[model samples]
Target: MSNDAPVSTTHAPQAGTHEVILEMRGITKEFPGVKALSDVDMTVRRGEIHAICGENGAGKSTLMKVLSGVHPTGSYSGEILWNGESAHFSTIRDSEHAGIVIIHQELALIPEMSIAENIFLGNEQTHRGAIDWVLTQRKAAELLERVGLSEDPMTKVKDIGVGKQQLVEIAKALSKDVKLLILDEPTAALNESDSQHLLQIMDGLRRRGVTCIMISHKLNEIEQISDAITIIRDGRSIETLRVREDGVDENRIIRGMVGRDLESRFPDHTPEIGEVFFEVRNWRVQHPVRADRLVVKNSSFFVRRGEIVGFAGLMGAGRTELMRSIFGRSYGNVLGGQIIKDGKELHLKHVRDAIDAGLAYVTEDRKSLGLNLLDDIKRTTVSAKLSRITDGLVVNEAEEFRYAEMYRKDLRTKTPTVEEGVAKLSGGNQQKVVLAKWLFTEPDLLILDEPTRGIDVGAKFEIYGIIQRLASQGKGVIVVSSELPELLGLSDRIYTIFEGTITGCLDKDEADQESLMRLMTNTTTRPETPAAS
Candidate 1:
């Protein structure tokens, strides 16, 4: 965006030139019961894109926190060298003052403020002790254009979607005159087009002499954009590989991160579909914002008892809307629909009704709608079915603790105790808590929306196993995932949706990535099966 190409920087010393902007030596950070980081060493070349790869809970974020002064200097034993000199930052403000900016996974934008105001929050343009609205709007507009966002600068932050908000965050960082930029899973919430756009923006920034340190689990994106890849595992630096070099493979990078060859990204499961257990007819849902527009058109599908049904679609393909509408009519306007459970029509007017009718929906966005962060594991596990612990009018503490403890062990949740706060747990563990909450309900049908998202491979396998076990226990399971491989591997039957319609349905023996992609992209039309004579 700055119209200046990045200056090529060398990693090691060559002749009389030394090429290093930032270097962290012997970094060690410890928590109460965990050694988050230990003897980690890393170096960043000026204007180079350096990628940090690791499994969840491998201390990648912890290392970045230390660099950004979130952990402070005295808490960690490390020497941060900037421009060939030792630097100690006491706070985030101190690091920012030194031309270092970090964009966290959870964006730090004020929802109530306009885009222009958010970009120039602490660093506003003032003229004669008064705010310069015209200058601020112009600068914000230029920054937005630079980042490939076409949204109005005066638009409220809450009105725009997550992807647009991400671009705004980057623009805000540019406003700070950042020299070293850190992005933590910036593309986690972006769709395909938006993700590609963000990656290109990062490339443009690199070309404009901006040094970047990206932490991401998206292996494909990491391999494509990174100049060098560093793998960390169990709080230790494994190895750093130059991706530009020959014979550097993704498998090798994954091995370095997880310490093993990932035999299969998705676990093996043979589904034995029985009689149809859940069915929907003439389902139509209106858009949440535009009541006149339909997000999910007249769609109908069914899942059998002991079957794993998969829904595959792109970002705006109406897969989530259909599920949410059926769950409780919780999402948008339901123009017309009838849900039949076990061959009987059931009322699903609200979340309570849906739950009572033997249905449960595990939301894709776990942070906001799924779990209660402020409550403990014991509380959240039983939150959905408080009646289980309620004796007459009051909840029995002993019964609640017993149920929570059972789930803690049964689900293999990684926590010190059941009383621990859900906020303190890892992403995978939090997902398990959400699963535990629904499993307590003992529903006949379980709808999992992106259940394994933002978690490690090991945790995904565990979730897959859970799904298979649920199907084996005669509970119908419906899984929605953007990852094609996951859908093909786990589902007994898959339904492809595009533009608010079910494009195709394939049995386990008939589905593959190519076929699914064809259906997803609307390239091939699905054949209709004749009704039973």
Candidate 2:
């Protein structure tokens, strides 16, 4: 937040010191009516971790696909030079043959397979046309050690945490003798500790003379680990900066990615928080499967008529389970609890009862629980309010289309038509559709779970604006997000949850990343600050 301007480091890197490992020039890709990338250019040093920076739908993934041959040689117009030789990769296998490996944002490991099995799934060790299990386990152990992991090769992939699985992926790449590694948002789903460990592994790879290319939205990590940074905007290369000498400024990088200076990432909204209109008191619930375990124990929280409340917790802290249980007992059996809305106590037996009781829940997994991807936009938008758009004995199609059109334009969803399938829309637009679906229900309270997860910065700001607008209209909003900065930026008041219980609650003026994380991990106990005025 300093007033100083970002330093300029747009010139190319010094050539005499570090050699160029890969280069792409005049890369252009088009899909249907969209021009994804237009004559983009990129360069990477031999042993440096180069970071690709851009907002969502900025062609970052597309450009990487072109380099890795996912788009194939003839599919796109680009010339790639690998170690001073032309690279005409026709398939992913071709790039792998050249020692190039790409780990996508979504992990590709099978859950049922063991660590060693996933590492050498397709490229396995063999002797005389037979699979060699012993050698495979030994080699997997070696790869795991190289990545600073001590996991058992026999352990199933599903048994490990997401952070450990990421290391397993790196071990898989090492098995291929990878020279150049491309990781696309590798730490997006990982927690703070896991992210730090992943970065350390990347540093280890760099020491071994491996060239690394990382695509990430976390500016702090990019600033910390990247030796060179390339900024892409609107399907074009803006500039590249040497993080050490160049301004290495966060504001400068953000401006380049957004095409303009954003004075504040979160929109300025002073909420007029009214009286406590919705309250959950003494709520206790048992684990969905393990009846002996209590997931939510003696948890009590309240939301005002016009307020944005945030729940801060680490992974598996029972934040999502608590909210899901309240929204129609979705996750666990409610042993004893009271949901009082406007002084009326009610019991919600099913999701329909929750929706009918003026409550709407937008799940974290938009693709799975929020919307039916194969269904068109119109059907998804009016799904929660079918009774409002239905006739005596049938669904009124025209009424549904009209409602969908109103929300499509209101939320600014980027779709050719309301008839378009939800699957075809980008992550951001699909999220907007999910929001629109709930908005039509006109609920008194909205529980948004990880609303901005896996989305771009621009889209995140838009969603923030929607949340602000919703609160401004006297609707109680509760948000659950993994990103602490997001909770700090958007929440008027934050409730820190730990082990399925409310550990501490802090007002906006007193909340910080350190304090929130401390409460989330149960490091500090006493947080009794009054709510902000």
Question: Candidate 1, which segments miss by more than 4 Å at Cα?
Answer: 1-18, 114-119, 124-168, 409-412, 508-518, 521-533
Q: Which digits, one per residue and each the tens of the lDDT, describe model 1 over residues 248-320?
A: 6678787888788888766666667678878998799988767777888878888889989899876667888
Residue pairs with backbone atoms closer than 3 Å in model 2 (clashes): none
TM-scores of all candidate predictions against the true structure: 0.86, 0.84
TM-score for predicted model 1 compared with the true structure: 0.86
In candidate 2, how many Å is residue 435 off? Answer: 3.0
Error of 2 at 177 (Å): 3.1
**Residue-wise lDDT of candidate 2 within 216-243, one digit each (tens)?**
8878778878888999987899999988
Clashes of 2: 0
Prediction-by-prediction clash tally: 1, 0
lDDT of 1 at 23: 94
Regions of candidate 2 where Cα sits further than 4 Å from its true position: 1-17, 107-120, 123-176, 285-294, 332-336, 393-395, 523-533
